[model samples]
Target: MEDLIEDKRQQTGEINLLDIECLGLINPRNTYAITILIYFLENSQDWSVRQEAARILGEIAFGNSEAINALLKVVRTTVHDELAASPDFTPNLESNSQIEFKQLLISSKILHNKPNLDFRASESLYKIDPGNQEAIKALINLSFWHISAWCTHDDAIELLKQIAIGKPEVILKLKKQLQSNNESVRGASAEIIVTVEPNNQEAINILIELLCNGGEILEETQDFFTGKRILEHIFKAIVNLPSPL
Candidate 1:
């Protein structure tokens, strides 16, 4: 495994999906396995390899603080890099302005240049630490801002529902996002809340409003499709809600 990791470092084609799968099939509790997976996750040039490493780390390194911290670093760095690559990004801005710019860019990036390593890392972090605020926030951003087909908005929302089960703070954050000006953000947030808290009248009301009145926030050319997607989320949530007394 160490040799494979080295070969991956020196040559991208030397390692492939089979190598990652073999690594995953090893005893997850093996310390060397954790170390090798972390190395691949942090150093590999191949995003797919890194994503697999992240997934395995979550499965094996459940309570390992070192592994959790590494996943956190990946999420933070990936998100910052994605935002920095935005066309509207400006360097040397004031601290507050930079922060605001990040928030704005989070909701408006139509094209995601980077792979979904950050999403995979954040999902792993959630598996390790459900209460991790950074992971929850990253998932929220991916749910709303990321428009890729590989990592759909529903993927993030489904994960958030699991994380929000007993985490009030996560629920609160999702509820707050329901009020976001971005219609997609609101719809995504509501979907999570309703899925987690079926009796959440506020979230149910918002879903109804989004279904009836929400515009296509995903794209102008794909308005009908995107709006239909949001409606699908609403219908699914409503169907799953408890029957009237």
Candidate 2:
């Protein structure tokens, strides 16, 4: 059966790859299936093939350490594009060298971008084992990345809240963030708690204290992390809820 699936995968047919995935679902706990799926995930040239392999790996190896680690590997993979690795400073360089030099001189940057696979893997880890500290940590690490235009910042925050649910250590981590001297960190921590546990008294108190002390960002300041709109909503949410006592 493994040989047949491998044959199908080598054919480079989407339908054939999907058939192998169905087999994975049928025998999620099979060692052969896990091995095959991981192979395709790491080595497949086709993005769809790699992506499906990852999706199935998460579902099948949901709580298994090896499976989780494989997913983490997928998420950890990064494609590097050197903006200006070697600056052409020779006088005899081609005409385009000057243009490239101008661009490089302005800013030589190597931007690190995480793939969607990481998002899927992190979510699957939490889904399979919400209490796994490593999974939660991975999700937190993912959150630190700059969200693309296609994805809203709120999406990451919501995902983080999901990680915090039923995880006391995660909740405590957020609470600690709330104590940071940085207002942005405190504001973010409070906002996260509001979503994770809306009725939590500590969350409410933090929101209230932030309102009284730090106040809101001025109209002129366009800071994304320490804005007034989120605090306004949090305050309203706490006000509308009954007392915790």
Candidate 3:
């Protein structure tokens, strides 16, 4: 196995297209085993080779979400911040250098973003209806390692909207967070979704429920993270909720 991997790597270095073809044949769908493929996809000195790797990974990951996320991590880490300062936001140009800069924004997020792949993988596995233990195990690892960074309250709320559409049960998790003691987490958790889309009835209902009937949540005036209107937004949400009391 290592011999085959070595040949593929060496072949790419030598600019051997035949070797590239062989590598593709060897690992048509098994990116997990084709670590050599990712190595080239990620770190080849040649832009053409790297581009080819990126292209192939895109195709490979179409059905296997694990492959997709693995590639996403590569994209995230290799993202060039200096180049991404003003993202194109052009609506579908995947190779825009601005994407490299977007990683900076991911770190700047006001709330936490968990990319560890645990939650991601579990969710993907469930979506595929794989119905087994291996998928759960993969998801757990994915979460712990990759997706566990902070996001803007905007990003979190946007994600919640996406989640709310597919899995209303996930709203239950957001519902629990609306009652949190930490002002930032709770405020961001509660208002993030409604602020972005404004049609989150369940989320809005939970926010109302928290403000009117939930326990006393102390307010802290310190600015913990920059650039997020998480708490101020939460206060607004509180005032906006209709009262039965």
lDDT of 3 by residue, 1-245 (tens): 54665676687744343454455556665554335446665455444554455545444334565555545444344223313432432234466577646644554431132232123433433333333344333322231111134332233344344545544444455556666655445555556446443665766765665455323432332333432343335557666555645
lDDT of 2 at 90: 28
Task: Return the top candidate by lDDT.
Answer: 1
Model 3 clashes, total count: 19
lDDT of 1 by residue, 91-206 (tens): 56666966777856553542342436777888889877757889888888888733454354667777788878888898898889877877767777888888778888988888
Error in Å for residue 141 of model 1:
1.7
Q: Name the weakest run of 10 consecutive residues (lDDT summed) in model 3.
A: 139-148
Indicate the residue-level lDDT of 70 in model 1.
86
lDDT of 2 by residue, 1-245 (tens): 67776676578643365655677678776777777677886666455566677767767776776777777676555432222222432234467966767655533221212344556666666666656666566555444323241242355567887767787788787787766766545655666777767777676776677667534443323555434555554566467656667
- Give RMSD to native, each candidate: 6.9, 6.4, 12.9
Candidate 3 stretches greater than 4 Å from native: 1-8, 11-59, 62-153, 192-228, 231-245
lDDT of 3: 0.44
Best of the two (2, 3) by lDDT? 2
